[model samples]
Target: MKLGNIEEDSKMSPAFFLQRLPAQRRSALHDVINIRHAYHKLCEICEEVSEFYGFTIFTDMAHNGILVTLVSYFLLVFFIGMIKVDLISCISYGVIIVWFAFQTTVLTSYVTRTIIQIEKTANVINKLIRQCAMNKKVEKELLNFRCELAFQKVKFTAWGVFSLDRSFLASSVYGSVHQRNLIYVKYIFFKILGLAPWKLNLVTKPSKNRTAKTIICKFSYLGLLYNVLLTTSVFLMTSYFCHQHNSVQAQVDSLVTPSTMMNLQYFAVILSSSVFLNYTCRQKDMIGILNEIIKIDKKLQKYAFNSAKNGNIIINLIFLGHLIICSTLICLQYFFLQSFWLAVLRCWPAFLYCWLIVQYTIMLDMMEKRFKFINLNIVKLGEIKVNSEGLEPVSATRISFLRESVLYDVVNIKDNYNKLCDICNDISDFYGLPFLKVMMYHGTSTILILYFMLVAYYESKEFHLLLFIKDVGFVLWMVFQIIILTTFVNKTIDKIAGTTATYLIILIQFRASTPN
Candidate 1:
């Protein structure tokens, strides 16, 4: 195809060139070009409207509403499927499922079609540039149009977080299911450890009434009893072993040795476990603290705190590392002692002690995140420029509204900070004794391990490489745990201090901005 005159073609509509083309080609090109133009115009209108109001005004609410509605329907269908329901009910559920599936399919199909149509428009533009006799001007315009089409392609999003397309449905479902499963896994892990003494009520919304019901489970008492009995057994066995070892050593007139250090370490572990058992007795308080923390997490989800994801992974990895180290030490004990039951009895307290420390450290890390999030908000408030110069004069009412909003935000942040402080106090009260015991155990163990290592290196006649390596490893592990625990605690303290400093800075700025 050939355009007779470039100037004339430019003067007429771009679609005028289609008149010279074949009937079939002309109709298709005309339709594609018209659709592209219409889509472009529609996108511009949507953009302007979105900018005038707000892009994400109802985004979260819409997404949550849809998710809840679909999930509720699916759950209803599932419950009906499980029961011996009447024929009408079964048919109704089947129809509901089918209707939802059909609706989802239709929505995705239409979105896919629109995307395909946009793609086709670009392809048609390319074909016209190559197949038709076009000047540099026409080719440049076509290329520019193609670039615009590519740049401004239509795609729906959920609060600008993720695209809504065929994959969205699958990903949304997968994410929801995975999250539910992960919560259960965490609950099971904590339940096994006696850290979570209460029952997990996944179906019911978390509230005071539900909390009471969940805490009423027999498993909580059983877990607590099991921990108490285990602590007692471990302590008694450790005491018996220490007594027998000391008696033998006294008869031989031996000085402090590796075996002696081991006895001391076992005692330290027993002491830590005993302290932890004391905390485990306050299951109701623990549950309440956890529920409050959950509420804090939910409240802060709108802020930068949401970016601090993969917390579960960190917790799980810490637990896994603890498990590996303890298992290795236990295996070594089994190999050397040649008594499975005795090795387990001797090593169990140490494992429990480390596990308790890990739990305490995890809680500290969570608190630190919340404090950090609050500090970030405070810093952001401090950074807000109070004086807006070389701008349109804002109305008195608008300025008053802005001032009220800022004050409201500050009040809300202050309230959250106060609540966080209360939560921290509760955590401290809950873990205070256990933390002290852990610190004592770590300090004594470290000094003894180091002293023994030094003595073994210089004064000992025979040095067992494996035993020496194990001693070094144990000392390093204890030091590492102590460092991690202290680091989280310090970070939380620092964030709290920073929050105060931020408030003072903002106050100074406000004073400086005010007229005398």
Candidate 2:
């Protein structure tokens, strides 16, 4: 139990080190430390996955060679599609081939690994729960740890289009296949008619000139035609070569199988349940603790009310931001693509983005509201009035009761504060990295879309008003989405800071009011 021995043992055994700490510190750190330990295990698994997938270079040449071959196989098909026997095609089908091939492998890997990781974590939690059946304290801690695990569940989504986890891939497979086929068919139809599949008429301004319309139409048709040819060639190459190569087929089939699809669905359900359990339990836990903190005296009620009033605007702002973002995403998807199914296909990323924004906002809002609620409780306890000397018998009894409440509140406040701190730490640990990844994906996708818009503008002879409107709306929607996302994180940080400051102020006031 000595500090020196504890320090020495910490490197080997954190749980042992924790046991030797004082009771309050032990309770506060136990869940936080254990959750972090689980997170480290996940990080280790990610590294191994990364190496296996050739994201990291191996010292072994043979392993590196295999990685190179896999990457080169896809790249070679794309490169071949780019060449038209004499010169490179203007349609840039190479990009499409590369995108699809890369997406196929990466998403497949992500889906498989994510499902396995979730299953492993779920198994671990179940085992821990069973082992701690008789120990309520340990069981409770394990439950919290499981929640933290679910919140930070492994996912691999590179940009909005390629992110495939078990749940997402399984659900989208049929629709995605149909959409892909539809797009391919459309490209073929346009090609047969000698029209461009990629070209859409854009207008810089209104024009009634017959010659201008003809010239603009011709330019669009040619541009679209070039793109169509390249993209179709790439798709043809991938399908044909995939059939010829057993290795490629095996790699693709592993992710597309019925068994793999089922696993992904199961993963989604388990992770979703864990996330719900954690948030629901955390809310109830906080409310229960607040009740304990408020029980000491009736005087603290008014202070709690005032604190809640102060936070009303923040809660409203959070909700308002979510509303705006959700609307923008829906409009972006629906407005540009006239076809319901095509819009759904193209705007799925925007939809997913909106969902994440709402999910994170709701969770953060709950935490922020609870933080303010607890502050109000603290204020109520702070304002309790002591009975004055020479008061009547009833008044004296009331004052005595109020004074006794102060002692109880003071003793328990520190413990409650520690618990609140644990709640905050656990949540941030659970959601921080995932949020960061989401933000990065949004930013990158926005940039890529903008690049395509610029290319379209440059290539078009004249802008069609309707096309121009759609482009502007799409860009604006992306910007708004980014704004909403960043604001979500910023608001949470602000709430955490405000809660911390409130804790200090209450502690100082309580100590000053005491007769010590």
Candidate 3:
């Protein structure tokens, strides 16, 4: 029964015995050794990736350097032109450049992090390749590792405009061009939004405990404050900008200047860029959680399988919504704005930004709900007792195995949950300041657009119905975008409250059931 004792009695080294063993035994030994080696290689890769990802000084400096240079150049030109007639315009341009530089810095930081992630993955595969050359016996196993690493490469975008890699850039452009097909767009619309009736089918059953409701309400209100502050900030920005100019016409023209329009569009694009970074980060986070879930000793693959299916559905829905919003906004701009070509040039950036924002928010909402759903299911698993419910009689050995499996599953679930929490914290760290900037800048843009409309309405000697509708529609679109944006954070908070409650209940029961 003891292989070590048998080998010792044979007076042979382990490798010598391995070579002399029966063919089947030798094959099994070879396999075990290979698996152990592969596992060690994978762990080393993970450690290297994690270490490189944390040391982002190089990426940080590169990204920051570009922005700082641009800001310096703009500042120098602005102050040089101060003695000229466009004093106020120069100040406005300077402010815009400063804001743009700040946003670019934040966006670059995120891109740098993603690049490091990709680089480390490549490093892992290359290391495996090198090992394969040294160990011809494990070549097949190393090849498999290479394939898996290739499959797991993080495909990220830079500012949602172009792919991080040149190859993906072509594919992204094709996808955007594909949206021009009205029939395809319509088909997708029906596929996602048309499936609304089935949403109830997918919903989790109501929880028996209602304590989560009160907590959810509290968190919802807290999230609502963000929406309120954003709206209030818009009004404050409107007043400040309006007071800068003496005449109403001057205010309107100043806000609508070619430079102002371009800056606003650029700001929207940058704000939308946050969505690409955030969405990619969340996905990477989910992959980490899923990996841990699959590592549990229990038959956890079934649960992980279901979770992955649900997550994919959520991601698909978000993509569908993004496409729909993009098409709608583009059409809206053409219908409402001046010359078709000019309108497309000026308005496309903001519209594209809106689409990305909506996509990001929807992804946020569904991801939080998915996390809550998975946690609640885990809690239910914890509630099952070996002897508390009716069941077929089993041998003591079987029952003991069952009990151990249940405990192991629960412990693994708790560990994975903690890892998921860390992912949330990472998201917050990445999004916090950039989100604030977006809300503040977007709020100001919305107010300026509204004020521009008001100034137009009063200054016109004759009533223009078409002009009024366009103005009102623009304002309405901005308001609607903000409402949708705020709902994502609110829903995420509510789901978090429910998840926390479920976790607490499971912990309490687990403690009570533990023997002294």
Candidate 4:
């Protein structure tokens, strides 16, 4: 969702956009107030619809995925039967269970996608509000616009929920809905349709809330617990063979599931889920962002009453929430890895799901760009004078105005504006981050993870032929991982990056100091 420099430059150019406005003389207090109010109302409607779409869509899929996954597991259990709990039966059960899990994942992803729409709508509304606040003329006329926008937002959001519920119920025909024994065709015909083809792929009509939270909750808990148990088996196996066997058979068992390998897989799952969960939220998060943007815009109505402390505090709260959520999910990931690391990783479908989670997290972080809302301060009473074109030059005119401005530099305030624009533009152009450069930053960790897998493989394996080749391969992999790790480490938590860089920088300095 990030943009490039030119786009940012365009947005920052107040004069350019203001030129598109009606003639200055015609731009009286009353003339454009209605138009602004209309736009604001439209934005509110979009916001409500988006919110409804987000919450309902997520809950629908989550509840349904839980149901389908449980049914899938039960079907696998039925297929395997109690009489045969042997290796062949176990593998069969796992395969079927994985199939069911994937089916549920598809619907979950769909609902998750709505978050993006929500985020978009929210951003738009917020931008509109910011504009209204910044305009002194509009502010006087559009004082009542906020109340209307709020009302419309609530109304549309309610409708969105109803629509989402219907959408999910109908579209969930691809899997077992209720019991494993009830065939898909029966449910499709009797429960969903009664021969009504229109309501086939959506959900049950009349929207009686057949979401079945109980079934979903029970199944999710069981599925998660089962996976955990599967991971714990590694530890159990480790203990079992630690002193039980001494021969090659014992070595074979230990070799079958290494703890470190399991740890790596677990780490991967955490990394992946962090991305996926965040991405799911990101899909429809724009709606909320827009809403928040409007609130910020309203706050800017009192731009002269600004405080750096409040600004920073608001920003910190957002980052803090993201950290807390990510941390909590990572813990869940560790448990899953500890219990069923091999089995889950071995399941290619599950692996993709895990990977998707990480991708989403990275994207979610990237989508959060609040720095653009920096308030413009009017310092001296006469500093905010109209230009020949009647547009704001983005700075105070008088040197004495510096004391009252956000930058506290009334002199050449245009320069400060230009500086912020330059940074925004460079980031947009160089990093393609009109907003946050999340994907680019996250790429570091993903690359490091992949390199480590290859490194671990080559380092542990033995081949007598051309022994030097193995050492070269190991070194190559290590270097690759280190490079990617360095970039990500530099951006996310720079102190760690600084500590590492000090050594490298000093080495570079030493090499230069030695004068070759």
Choose the strongest candidate by lDDT.
1
For each candidate, the alpha-carbon lDDT, in order, equals: 0.64, 0.48, 0.50, 0.37
- lDDT per residue, candidate 3, 381-437, as tens digits? 656652433365667687577678777867766665565566566555545654565
Best by TM-score: 1
List model 1 lDDT by residue over 244-348, tens digit each.
Answer: 544332111146665765667576756756664675678777778777777676666656455225244555567679877876776666656666666676666
Work out the TM-score per prediction: 0.58, 0.36, 0.42, 0.27
Cα displacement (Å) at residue 30, model 2: 69
TM-score of 4: 0.27
Off by over 4 Å in 4: 1-65, 72-147, 150-152, 155-240, 248-487, 493-516
Of 3 and 4, the candidate ranking higher by lDDT:
3
Could you tell me the lDDT of residue 197 within candidate 2?
25
What TM-score does candidate 2 get on C-alpha atoms?
0.36
Task: Give the TM-score ranking, best first.
Answer: 1, 3, 2, 4
Tens digit of per-residue lDDT, candidate 4, span 253-272: 23334554445434544443
Candidate 2, residues 1-516: lDDT per residue as tens digits? 122233344456567546644453355446545665867687668645654654222233245346556555655444434323323432344454556557555666757876686658656766655542223454566677677666665544433333345433332223434333433443344333222223323234444753211112212334444544544443344334333432321111332464443343233333333332333334334334333333322233423332223333443454456555545444544444434443343343344444545545545654555555656556666555322322335465776777787667655655555555666666566555445545555565566556556766676645556555655666676576567656766766676577567767767866675565
Q: How high is the lDDT of residue 456 in model 2?
A: 61
Listed per candidate, the RMSD to the true structure in angstroms reads 15.6, 26.3, 19.2, 20.2
For model 3, the stretches where C-alpha displacement exceeds 4 angstroms are: 1-251, 254-300, 307-322, 335-341, 386-395, 460-467, 507-516
Give the Cα error of residue 169 in candidate 2, in Å: 41
